[model samples]
Target: MFGPFRLTSPLSGGLLWKIPWRMSRPQKARQRARLRHVDKVVSIVDQALAKKGTTTAAVERWKAEMPVEQEMLPRDKYTIFDRKEKKYRKGIHKLPKWTRVSQRLNPPGY
Candidate 1:
């Protein structure tokens, strides 16, 4: 966008700034939604960390705070529906809390 025509003689040169492109309404809305979701997660994590006290706490404390490592067993087959995917998830509650697992960590109720 910055071409030779953008340039001017010293007499005509004061400032030649480029105007930034703005997002469309839909794009802006989507970005705002994503930001809100991220902010919500950050706030929850901050609160959890604060409530958990020191970084080096007891094993029991860590166990009480962290999410379980096992797959969640839903009470019913159709506990939740994913709107974005446009599909019905059966036994959705039977999903795991943590994507990764270790021998030590497990879900709270598990």
Candidate 2:
């Protein structure tokens, strides 16, 4: 008794949302710009704090641990490590809120 009146499933199987396999060139450019802006902001803050003759542990740790934009390899800047992904890497954009979050590091030798 299957007909338009019969109810089982309203939709067939298919991908509801498709994510791009990789980022476009313009997106990469924008990502780089954002990285540079973050670096600039950090340096500005450090300078301002120095002028005031004070430094916070957070600022010191950031400078000690994070490599500035110029020092990061393009691979590290644009991709992140994922154990399930082929070649153990996936595009940064694959992560939710990637633009707003800083993903500047991966496991060493990943």
Give the winner by lDDT: 2
RMSD of each: 18.1, 6.2
lDDT measured at residue 92 in model 2 versus the true structure, 0 to 100: 97
Which clashing pairs does model 2 show? none
- Model 1: per-residue lDDT, tens digit, 1-110? 36766645533667543422233466435534443454466456656777987333444454464333222232221233334333343223223441122223222332
Clashing pairs in 1: 68-106, 68-107, 69-107, 72-93, 72-94, 72-95, 74-93, 74-94, 77-91
Q: Write the per-residue lDDT of candidate 2 for residues 38-110, one digit (tens) a residue.
A: 9999899999999999999988998999989999999998999999999999999998999999899999989
Count of backbone collisions within predicted model 2: 0
lDDT of 1 at 103: 22
Residue 109, model 2: Cα distance from true site in angstroms: 1.2
In model 2, which regions exceed 4 Å deviation? Answer: 1-16
